[model samples]
Target: MMDAHRQNRLRALTTPVVLIAILLIFVLIVTATGDKSLARMAAQTLIRVIFVVGLWIFVGNSGVVSFGHAGFMAIGAYCSAWLTLRPQMKGMFLPDLPPWLASAEWPHLPATVVSGVLAALIALFVGAAILRLSGIAASIATFAFLAIVNTVYSNWEGVTGATSSVVGLDRYADEWVTLAWASVAVFVATLHANSASGLALRATREDEVAAAASGVNMYRHRLLSLVISGFFTGVSGVLLGHSLGVLNPNSFYLGITFITLAMLVVGGIGSLSGAVIGVLVLSVLIEGLVRFERGVDIGGASFALPSGAQEILIGIIMILVLIIRPSGLTGGRELRLPVLGWRVRHSKQEPQSTN
Candidate 1:
């Protein structure tokens, strides 16, 4: 007879375990195939897993839409570049950086840690000012934050290279590295979701007035979740910089934001399993379409999707998913291992109020 606490822990553990298993299989098959392109795609998918899970930590629990995470991501990427680039290169490329930054260099892991912490700190302050707002206004505020960050990063030549892409970053975030970090992201998100604050935040998400009346500190929980969310979001950005060996403000802006949010929504915003599954399904779909765009042969006949068809098709898929299953593909249920005798459970919905 397992204790209730122990049983709950086992259930929570299954989602991450299943995800790790899937990633292991992906890496093994790709490596065994000796296909470098497939290996690269696998690495990219792992990174997206990290990004989507990070968003889930904040958006799913708080039931708030955030368009501002990309700003923190940009901060993280540029910050990593400042720390990891050789002093000589920094001085040459980012000449206007502060003397200490221009003359300092650090390894990827340490730089990533520092970048996450800095982004979290920024979120703490920003959330303090904005998390008080509720509903659509809060969503609009986040969009404003993203716009402001983009404008500054796009024009600030001294630090972010303005519109030019910053290069020379070490390509250290390979498949294994991204896999490890993506695992960490899931662990962090699960732990947070199981914590007291996460529950209190979700309470507010269900009914703000009821939660506040019940003594939940809505503002505090929202701010804490935002800070935690910013941390992982920033780490993902550091990984992005290393993976691509460059940084561009525009790269972290609209395109990445839309795809990531789409993944989260398509996966079911209420479950961690949804976040992981969404990334895997969409990544594979997009990759397949990309290959088809290059051309495909079926039954000895050549076929190809036009350029940009992948984007258009993905958009259609997202719309159909939303129209057909608004609760998402997971129906808001978390994944569990059958060997554990645990069944996936959907989130309980609040009764609709006619008010």
Candidate 2:
């Protein structure tokens, strides 16, 4: 009995273990190749992992599609810029700042954490009202939230630079730094998915009427998931800003919102492993398309795709995936060890037969 239980526990661990190992291997290969562009691509991929997994915490478990998360990301990116940028630079670009925020300069690490916390708090506040709705209504509400955020940031001349890009941020988010955060995101996501709230929220997803009958507080669970989701999504934003050494309101708009959603839907929004896998697959394809646009050298001639072909191609691929496998590439399942699962089932059968 104990042995069977141990096997089950080990089986439960296989998904995250495999995911983290995959990331470590990817980094090792990139480092061995010593390609700066590959490293940049890897860093961006990790950032997407963090953001998509954060989205998974809410959308995967609660079965709610959100278009507003990028808004939280915008908040975090700008918050990090406000905190980390030098006081003198802030004064130069953002002259109408409050004395405390204007004069302050913070280190990157703390700024990242605080940025996430601020985004989470905002999620909690907004989710209190938004999570009460269900289905398409809820999705629309989230989209509205994103629009509001974008508008505010675009017009907030004194604080967010009013459509102008905030520059001079330190480009400190390299591959290793993003890898650490991605690992943390996977860990936190796993922990949340296995929690009681996660389970209850999923129950609500499967059947809202039945779950409510079973005493599952859908609102609370959904709200909790959103808070957690907002945190990592916000952190991803900070990483993006630090990596590029720039921040702009437009960066966190519809383009990113749709692509991340496409990653989630394509990778299997119903499964955690799907989130990570989706990011890797799409990021690689996008990078390849970018290279093609830049003109790849063939045996004797340079071949290049037309600019903007990547988006159209990606959209077609997404449509094909949806039509072929609506549940996503992983079909909404975690990575599991078949042998361990068999052993566990066999062990239970053995005890029943002995009795």
Candidate 3:
């Protein structure tokens, strides 16, 4: 019995453990190559993995598609920048900032935590009202929220650099840094998926009316999921800014919003495994397309795709995937220990036979 309990515990952790192992191996391989470009791509891919996993926390469980997480990312990026930038730099570029923020400079780690919390706070506030409305209405509201954030940041010259890019940030978030965060995101997502709120939210996703009848507080669970989702989404933004050493409002706009969503949908938005795998698969394809656009050498001949062709090709691939496997690459299932699953199946059958 003790052995069985221990096996059950190990089985429960299988998903997150496997996901983190994959990320670790990916980083190790990239490091072994000693190629700067591949390392950079790996870093960016890890960031996207965090973003998609964060998105899955809400969308996967709630079955409500969101278009506003990019805005949360923008908020975190700028907030971390504000906290970490030199006082002189902030004064020069963002003279309009409050006195405390203008003079304050902080380390990246705490700033990351604070930025994530702030993003979660914003999500909590916004979701309180938005989650009240069900279905498409809520989705539209989230989109509107994103647009508002973008417009405000774009025109807020003194604080966010307006239409200009904010530079001179610390570029410390490399592949290893992002890999750690990606692991954390996967672990947190796994916990949430197994939590009561996550289970209830998924129930609501399956049948809203039935869940409500069963006494699941739909609004509460939805809001909780969104808050959790916003935190990691925000942290991913912080990593993106630090990795590139620049912050731009437009960087967190429609392009990232749709691409991340595409990754989640392509991977199987209903499972945490799908979120990570989707990012990996899509990132690799995008990287390959980018290399092709730069021209590949074949037997002293040059082969190159047209500039911007990658986007079109990726779009086509996503469409094909959706057509063929709408449930996503993972089919809404997690990575589990196969033997453990088999044992559970046999156990159920054994009980049936006894009856």
Candidate 4:
């Protein structure tokens, strides 16, 4: 029995160990080669990992799909951009702004935090209106929210530059910043997943009527997840805005929303670790494939994919994953370390059992 328990412990630890080892290898490769470009790519990928993980927080736990996360991200990007861009530039570009917004020039960190707060507030308001819906209704409502936000940002020139790109923000993102934010996001998500509220949310996901019968307020739990997801997604937007040093309303358009949703779906909508791995794998593939030379030879012939091939590839992958592993790679399993004594005893017992 002890040996069986040990084997279980070792099995539990294997996934996490492999993931950590791979992460460390990636870091070492980027650092040792002095590749700033690759490092930047890695940083951006980590930031996005946080954003996808945020999606998992709500959609994974509650089993409610959301397409409005991009709206929260847009809110954060614009808020941070407005706050941190030079005052003089704002005066030129957005002269009709409110006195407080026009007068203040915030540092990057404070601006990022404020952006997150603004997104959270918006999410709270929206959640109150939409969380009462079930299944497809909720999903459609969230998509409508994204459309509304996109329209507003596109037409609201004074605040969002209308259709033009917003420019001239300080660039302050690096690997350390990306990793720190990702770690915080992971910690928060894990805590929430293990919390009482999380349990209630999960119960709601399993059976809303049953959960309600048990006195679990489904709306309240769903709202909580939405707020948390919005907060982290907002932070991700800040990182993205800073990393790019420019922003555009169109950048957060439906294409982006679809791509993100695809990532979550392919990674396993029910699994957080699956979400992270899916983002890592897909992001790398998409970005890396784009760098291939135009005339590369394949099967004795020269060929190159079109500019938008990555998106197509992602869609295909999503379909395949859905068909083949609908539960996701990890199937909602968490990575954990093994107990050494358990594994050693299990190994010894395995030989005796074989004899």
Candidate 5:
């Protein structure tokens, strides 16, 4: 009986099973439909999986709300532009870039990596200062950091193209590439969740005073999670830039920030599977609403939703989910496949050590 229980724990404790299942489902749908528009939507959803999962790495474990990750996304997007754009295009569009950056052109692989690294470095440097705070104060500091980043990027004309879209980015992130990164995000997140740092952070999230008394360095764990989260968020930004063949500071602002958070919370911020499932469910709903707005054919007549109905409808859904399940759909539980008569559940009152 103990061995059977142990096997279930091993199976449910890791994130790869959930991710693989999700991937298989997504691929099956894409294959069956073979629709270009649907494929594009899938790519976008996968990208969101990366974003929400990365955000989960920090926010889920630390219990700290972050409005600053989008800034890291913007930084990553622009960093990709700096590394991957042709020299001539950089001269024309980003004249004020330092001399070396202006001439440097790298392939998508290296550029994507560098973009993530740069964002992680920035997170490391800034998080050392910011992670010292806790609760709402820490959340506010992150928001302030985000505001500062957005303000600077929006106004820096030559380096960031200011408020204008930076065109000529290479379109390299198709559905497959996005899937690869999303898988990486899931794997990394799961690994960290089972690691010492993730557990330490979650301990602090539950009771900071107790955790600190136990010799768990709250600040260090939070900073580490922030850096890891920043890296994956940065990668998502690079994928988005390549998908659109353009970079814009506004794209990484509040709109993306709020929606991602909504997804994370609705799916269960306490579980790794929550991040992936949230993106999948919410993205499908948004895309469906978009299609309805474009008009749907029913018995030879086209019915269309009003222009802004999608937002309103999605907002209602979010509210309903929050009201119905405050802890989210997964309720802090990992993926546990049922075996015969055995049932699996996470006790809500008891916080799991593997966050």
Candidate 6:
């Protein structure tokens, strides 16, 4: 009986282990590929992965859907852009800046850290306010926050260049840099998920009233998750700015926010591995479909999709995923290396005998 129980436990561990191995192999293969454009796409995908993972830390662990992560991203992007862009040109561009603001030159690393910290601070305030609400109200409040942020970013010319896209940022983000940051974000999120505070956060997510009855500080946990998520999302925004070499208020608008949310939902809201898978699958599908349309010829003539076809396709896929598997592809499964051809862990118990 004990042996049988042990076998079942081992069997339960198999799935995640195998998944981890496969994921590692996939990463290695992509990194080794000699295609520069593909490499660049992978790098961009990594940045998106970071953003989605950040969302997962809050939405997945806390069961609170947030549409305002883009606001945090915008904060990070603008902060990093302002810090790293040529200080000499600030007078030409941001003419109204204070004398001190017009003459600050910041290196890359410090600028990125500062950007992340600022975003975290913003999230601390926003989360404290919105986390007090429950259910749909919380979700709606988050969406409203997104709209408010967009409006401010669009019209705030003194700091954000108003509706115009901010330009001339130093391009320092690459695949390796993005990957390093992504790894860090993933590690931090995973650690948080397993810690005592993470358990309390998960309890609050599972049942807020019950958790509160048990003396868990629900609001505090939610706020902490939001702050942590904001910091990483900010880092992703910095990477995005550097990657694109420009910053635009419109880039972090509703469309991008929804897409990132979709990525998290389709990946699985309760698991980190799900977030990574969702981003990989969506990014590949969108990019590949667009490329296919660009390359295909129909009836002896070249064919190409309209500029926004990718968005439409992604939307369709999201709808299908929601209808078919709302919990996401991995559900709550983690990606980990397998032993003896098995993945995932299962609790062991003795089987009931009919005799």
Candidate 6 lDDT, tens digit per residue, 150-248?
898888787777887777887778777887788778878877787677889999888888999999998888898899999999999999999988888
Q: 185-293 in candidate 3: lDDT tens per residue?
A: 9999888888888889999999999999999999999999999999999999999999999998999999999999999999998889999999999999999999999
Model 3 — TM-score against the truth?
0.95
**Ten consecutive residues with minimal summed lDDT in candidate 4?**
12-21
Off by over 4 Å in 4: 1-25, 293-303, 340-355
lDDT of each: 0.88, 0.92, 0.93, 0.81, 0.88, 0.81
Candidate number with the higher TM-score (1 or 4):
1
Q: Could you arrange the candidates by TM-score from highest to lowest?
A: 2, 3, 1, 5, 4, 6
All candidates: TM-score: 0.93, 0.95, 0.95, 0.87, 0.93, 0.86
Q: How well does candidate 1 match the true structure in TM-score terms? A: 0.93
Q: Where does model 2 exceed 4 Å of error?
A: 3-10, 337-339, 349-355
Tens-place lDDT per residue, model 2, 171-235, is 99999999999999998898888878888999999999999999999999999999999999999
Error of 1 at 229 (Å): 0.5
lDDT (Cα, 0-100) at 303 in candidate 5: 100
lDDT of 3: 0.93
Pick out the ten consecutive residues of candidate 6 with the lowest summed lDDT.
340-349
Tens digits of per-residue lDDT, candidate 1, 90-174, equal 7767889998889888877899999999999999989998998998899989989999989999998878889988889998888
| Higher-scoring candidate on lDDT, 1 or 6 | 1
